[model samples]
Target: MKKLLVITVFLVAASAFLFGATYRIGLSLSTLNNPFFVTLRDGALQAAAGLGVEVIVADGRDNPAKQLGDIEDFVQQKLDLIVINPTDSDAIVTAVEEANKAGIPVITVDRGASGGMVIAHIASDNVAGGMMAGEYVAMLLGGKGNVVELEGIVGTSAARDRGEGFGAAISKYPDIKIVAKQVANFNRAEGLVVMENILQANPNIDAVFAHNDEMALGAIEAIKAAGLLDKIKVVGFDAIDDAVAAVNAGEMAATVAQQPFLMGQLAVVKAFEYLTIGTIYIPVDLQLVTSK
Candidate 1:
């Protein structure tokens, strides 16, 4: 009887040991300063809570080296899975490879990496979003206008693809010339400064299309300061809260709405799914948002 009782206890202990460990996820975001990314983080947190998993978040602050370091740290910690919103898609490959070497699966959200093995990538189609923005802007100008393009971070897939799609659509209208194209690095302050400089070079710009809402807001500041808001229309991507408000107030024209919250939630879901069934690759949706 004593032997039987001991065996039963050992079996229960073994079972508990095998099944009691809670999964941990590492989420690295590009930048929390951007309101869109903040929304993405909140959505991810909500999903993690629902799944009974622990998530440790790291902010890259739009620095590629820092983002890479964050991924390496997660690898060292031996986290169950790592989700990265890469600051620079090309620069993040080595870090993702390191995680792969550690036998940890990786998931990229929002912006994807240029290389490396990812269990799944969950994000909106940025190219399509960009095309939509271009078409809308062209229509606003009646297919002929002097336009300024405020670009995002250089070398990142989001920047490249968005620019590509926008250019493709704008190419249809030869009369609509891109008078000035500058990289604002997806920062509000830089956007303002860049727009101010561009305004000096091309005083009669008809419209502006910024890669993100932050830049759009910055351009609006410059336009307002110069008293050219009535003349120049602005279209921005990422329908952040402020951008939405701006649109309603007639300060901006339109914006492409990427479902960041849904993308975040789905990223977590896919991470969990990969752990369970080895599933990979989840796609999110995007939409064009205009003033109501």
Candidate 2:
């Protein structure tokens, strides 16, 4: 009886190995505190289920060091693939290199690493999205307005590119002056505080452009507190549900919508493809969301 039991256990283990029970994927997200990122995580989880794989997720919590540590853990675990939503584009290079050294393919979602070999990068054209927002603001203001910019986290490509695009669009209208620009770190609370200070500094500002809806929403709060809501037009990115509702309510001017859910799903699909066939880079689309 003992011999028969041993034989059966051996057969079960062999079968499991032969059939390749599951593929392990490591997802390192920049932060899970925001609703947009939460949606992204859900999309990835759903895709992993459909592909019959398991995904282990780690949140960087918007810290570069934490993101690096998470990548190191993924590498040490010898995961089949690693997907990163970088907190800082340049800061993530070292982490990406380590993953490359481990021979584990890396895919960036929503944000790209400034250096190292990334097998695939999946995100929207942020520059174009920013340009769309800028143009909308210009038209609404009739090409002449004093605006304040609530920037995202520093050292991030998303912030840099979007700022560049906004600048390029507004340059055409010399009358559109950017009175003050400040970084809110893409946090709602920070946005509120920073915007409150900006309001005190520039009392007559006509418009505000925030890199993301979180910051924009915070700015709106500040505007309401100061009784400047009717005078100030706010534009934002991400088109998150709340932001969309704000637009419909005429509380916000417009927003450029980047599909975080789609980005997450595609990142997982590309990761699976890389494991099976090879590497591939995919660019997703961004849309302009407006009240009208």
Candidate 3:
């Protein structure tokens, strides 16, 4: 009877620790398929584990409705907080509001919503990265060239800021013209097909500015297959491993490296701080990350 009583006491203590110890946070990613986001997710996972927080993974899959649903579920579950990689800025407003209504903080990563204030917004300087891409290509072509630009998903801040910044940078060199521009939706397959067509149609193209490295690598493949490997220069954003290798091999010119892991880690760190301090740490001015 004595042994039984001790074991029962131990089991009750273990159960209490398990339930009481968890600091649950809900996570919503823009898309689980993107390598950039995968790195970000890894950082969030690591940070949450280190902080003894439970992260409930939710896949947005680049769908605003899906992301909203996931956030609603989190609100219903009464999770501690939320980390959102918004699919669309406008569409994410209500979802962030939902978190706010539940008294749960929302930390945005990679993308920010247009409304419903969040605890923190974690992202790289996408606009500056685009400027770097444009300058690198212009330098490669001696400030005069016909360039084809590969864009990411339209409407999102990443694509819009990158395109606008790159356009502004390239406009400084009047001789450099964007012969063609197309949205590849940030997918490798779309990039390959679109770039192939662009190459066939624009045989006089001098370079390419891909908004992200995946599309840039895809464009490189198409350029090689079309027999324009050495004739065309390619600049991309996000110094992913393959892009770095290509840069070293002379297949790609340069990439604006964004520390995606750091972005995610900061988001998680801020989320925890919001829980404890009820505030965030987003800087008052621009935080830019540019260069290889």
Model 1, span 1-292: residue lDDT tens: 2354234334433443466645789999999999999999998888777666788999999999998889899999999999999999999999999999999999998889989998778777889988999999999999999999999999888888889889999999999999999999999999999999999887899999999999999999999999999999999999999999999999999999988887777777677666654564333445889997
* Model 3 lDDT on a 0 to 1 scale: 0.82
Give lDDT tens digits, candidate 3, residues 1-292. 2354234334433543555645688889988877888888888887676666788888888788998999999999999889998888788999998788878888888777888968677788788878888888788999998999999877678888899889989999999999999999777778899999997787899999998888999999999999888999999888888899999999998888988887776666667655654454333334688895
The clash count for each model shown is 0, 0, 0
Model 2 TM-score on a 0 to 1 scale:
0.89
RMSD in angstroms, all models? Answer: 10.2, 10.2, 9.8
Model 1 alpha-carbon miss at residue 7, Å: 40
Clash list (residue pairs), candidate 3: none
Write candidate 2's Cα lDDT for 213-265 as tens digits. Answer: 99999999999999999999999999999999999999999989988877777
Structure candidate 2, residue pairs in collision: none
- Score candidate 1 by lDDT: 0.87
Q: Which pairs clash inside model 1?
A: none
lDDT of 1 at 69: 89
As a whole number from 0 to 100, the lDDT of residue 228 in candidate 3 is: 89
**Quick one: ranking by TM-score, best first?**
1, 2, 3
lDDT, residue 116, candidate 1? 90
How do all the candidates rank in terms of lDDT, highest first? 2, 1, 3
